[model samples]
Target: MTISTEMLWLIIGCAIVTWLPRILPFIFVRALTLPDVVLRWLGYIPVCILSALVFESLLDTSGPIVSFHWSKVLTFVPTLAVALLTKSLSLTVITGVVVMALVRFML
Candidate 1:
C-alpha cells in the first residue's frame, strides 16, 4: 500500500522525537562524567518528581491552602506512610484508594 505524504511525515516525526532524548543523554553523559552523588540522586529523580507532583495535585482542596477535608488528607497520608514503610507501589496505591473510598463512603 502506498503511504500518503502525511503518513511519511508522521513516521519521520515519530523517529526524530524518539531519537532526540535518547541521543541527548548519550552525548552529554559521554562528554562529561557525572559525579557519583549526582548519579545516585538521578536514580531518585522519577520518584521525587512523582511524589512532588502527586502531593501538589492532592493538597489542593479548593486552591493551595492548608485545609483538611479529611478524605484527601486521610487518603494521602496513609498512602505515603504505607509506601515508605513497605516500599511497595501496589500496596501503597491499593491501601490509599481503599482508605479514601471507605472514608468518603463512610462519612
Candidate 2:
C-alpha cells in the first residue's frame, strides 16, 4: 500500500495526539513527590477501574436493571480466590481465562 504525504502527516498527527495525553501525565507526575494521602488514594484507582470493567463485562445491559451472568459469577469465584491466595496478576488472569473458557464450553 502506497501512503501519500497527507496520509503520512495524518498518521503522525494521530500518533502525537494519542501519545501526548498518555505520556504527559507521567512526565509531569514523575518529577513531583505526591503526598501520602494522594498516594493512598491513587492505590484505589486500579481496583476501582478493574471492578468497573469486570462488572461491565459480567452484566447484560439489555434492560438496564443489571442482569448478571451466572457463568461469569461462577468464573469470578475461582479467579478471585486465585488472586487472593496467590496475589499474582498473571496467575489470576490465567485462572480467569481458563475458568471462563471452561464455563463457556460447558454451557
Clashes of each: 0, 0
Question: What would the TM-score be for candidate 1 when compared with the true structure?
Answer: 0.52
Q: Please write out the lDDT profile of model 1 over residues 7-101, one tens digit for every residue.
A: 99999999999999979998889889899999999999998998888776666568576654557876778888998999998998899889988
For model 2, residues 22-87, the per-residue Cα lDDT tens digits are 899799898999999999999999999989998888898787586888899999999999999999
Off by over 4 Å in 1: 1-23, 35-47, 61-70
**lDDT per model, in order?**
0.85, 0.94
Q: After superposition, how far is residue 17 of candidate 2 from its true place, in Å?
A: 5.3
Q: Model 1's lDDT to the true fold?
A: 0.85
